[model samples]
Target: MNPATRSAFPGFAWSLSRQKTLAECPRRYAYEYYFSHNGWLADASEETKRIYRLKKLTSLEMFFGSSLHNVIQNAISNYSKSRKIPRPDDLVRLVRSSLNAAYIDSTRHYGLWFDKPSRYTMFRDVYYGDGLPPDKIEEIRSRIGACAESFPKSKTFREISGGRNVRLMELERFRTLPFADVDVVVVMDIVYRDRDTGRWVVADWKTGKESAEDRTQLALYAMYLQKLYDIPSIRDITIRNEYLATGTWREYKLEPIDVDNTLYVLERSVMEMRRYMEDIDGNVPYELEAFPLTEYTRHCERCNFKELCGR
Candidate 1:
């Protein structure tokens, strides 16, 4: 991976920052939000180093995601032109460039370590272990290379249009809402508006093990659409985790009423938080001490105030 020339979506305003901090650690939020303090980790610990390395790799994955998204987005845009979807080369180039940018960022962030054998050794041990032999590694590498071979044909694109990217219109209310202050926000990897059926469908490309919880998450997104956007035409929400390891796609879809009920739960959670905030003094000292280690592992894992919290 290479370094990023700039941060992703610079100047993107985020109300989720407070929620992100709180999710990381209430003490961290209290310190940063109330005290204006920035020293969160007191310099990088061993875990911090590990996290930073993982982040660089994650940045590379982000590039891959962006590449795939651009390819698919462009295909959607050009559906009217040439009666054909964009080629994979267009997206593959973007992915490679994005990966280069990731490398650049990692080089800057980790210095010489980005190129060090020690780093590679650590990454492979952590991410790959001994699961891959040399030939298998090469084979997998070739498949990734083949990702650039060709774009989806028109017929193929048409078939997949039902489960491709859905543009996310980030709503301010969604960000600042009492209960539904989403920690991370992303639109469905695929959303199709079926003109013939008069229905909207949502899908996400996933690359992990599936669980009932994953289906619930997709259902939750559907709930968001109905409650926040009032797009009552959404008939199905699907979660598909395509496993790269096994080359299999696992899918689950949500019923409309089930999604609606999920929205009801979200509404109640937000209303409760709203009521709680009404009685709280904004100027009062942030009571981080009330947060305990048993509450969440993230506090110990990421909070700069971990030492103080433990004290």
Candidate 2:
């Protein structure tokens, strides 16, 4: 262990994913770290522009998410219509206002995936699965419907917990210490205390489909949370995919072994990042990972990064 790794605070300093990325390739790290560039070439080719255009239509999917949010907000408002309990209507309005503000904030805001319409439609439609048996399709649709109906009322916190992007933890002994070295930080969606089990949970909001790889991301998040917060016996953690296209939410849990594996990976990543930062060799031009942006699944067609990735 590096001597600098020993902190008066018991938990880890950075999220595992952030550390992992830094270790994977320092040039990629520089782009993501200091520059805040997600490998996006603002001045893109015509083909990339076309793909971006098609992607814009998928913003239409927000119609489904906002429609359901409105429905649930209405339900909550009606539920509290008789009494003084708070409602989700304000939150819905706030989200809408923020999105509009973001649109206005952009200098040349065309929209998401502006170049690829058929790809967007095909991706969504296929995920909805035309080849499935009629009964199976109905069952899947019904599950999505149920999720749309139940999500706003289930395990919801009044306000997005931990605030916006970065959470602040006050170390009692380090009250006077200025945090100068900390540049990158991770923001999670929700934190839950199970009603029946009395266990702590960290829930991340995913707007895409769930996969085993997504579980790995959650484990990394959980391990960082445990290390940072000094929370122990932190067993059950989940990544909840609130699908925008289908108006559904699915939960994926992280097992103990997965958490341990992620931490092992994380520690090694941190050590490598520290080493790369100290390297004084000849200037090495930074290069983003070639496969890092590759379209691993059909879903890659929908990614905003697909054009930059040359997928």
Candidate 3:
């Protein structure tokens, strides 16, 4: 596709998240990246408008994950700059405050668009749900507190926090690697160079359950860094997923074959997305048929487009 046409669609760049969305549900992917591309136009179609609205949907789990990530990010950032970690209580307070703001924003703006509960409401339900005692709030607070406190004490944290042998990469920095015909975007949660071993360490903070996709995401980051720095081999990069919820860590070392597989997956994903968006006749409008709702009903359960799909 030409640059203009590519720019008109959502899968133009092959980020891991974009690939996952396309894999989970092409219709959802199209709604998010394709149809919604022109959603804000005054004369946009009803389908476009609907997809645009559904695209704004968020879950409590996502909010909680993002809030936790922010806390950890801030803690590390503070330590990296000042050589001091925030108190656990202060970190918990930060999480609470950030979550509260997000809750208010969701309730006031995006809550009415979806049939599901608002973020604030979901938080309350979980905090006060039946079959659980009033200590639910304390349980959550304790987990957040512990997770924050544990970060500064981790071996990896110590290595990258500040030392003569290591250099910290700015947190939340976006880097892109150009492949075949697309750019793969990756934003690492934390990355640093180990001067002693001449190795690059990349870590992503996760507050959710572990999944196979985590490996794929890390592999992509490794590939991007390799290309970005012109590293001689993928072996020089190490990937880690720091699961904050349970203070568990997963590490990965990418093989040349793994990088090959990651590239293949990305190329195939892009090809499939392009096939889904094929419009031979310039006169034809983008249709629901172009991106069909997934046959897998289970995926629709938590999908924001469930109501839109009449499920």
Best by TM-score: 3
Question: By the lDDT metric, which is better: model 1 or model 3?
Answer: 3
Clashes of 1: 19
Quote the lDDT for 169 in model 3.
70
- Report the lDDT tens digits of candidate 2 across residue range 85-138: 334454445444543443332323323323333322222232223222457445
Worst 10 residues of 3 by lDDT: 124-133
Write candidate 1's Cα lDDT for 150-200 as tens digits.
Answer: 235222243454354433332332332223443324345554444454445
Among these predictions, the greatest lDDT belongs to 3
Ranking by TM-score: 3, 1, 2
Q: Which ranges in model 3 have alpha carbons more than 4 Å from their true place?
A: 1-11, 40-47, 108-143, 162-164, 279-286
Candidate 1 CA-lDDT value? 0.44
lDDT of 3 by residue, 104-209 (tens): 6554534442333222333323222332234754566666776777666665786775565898876446767788777778878888898888989998887667
Candidate 1: RMSD to truth: 9.5
Ranking by lDDT: 3, 1, 2
For residue 303, give model 3's deviation from the true position in Å.
1.0
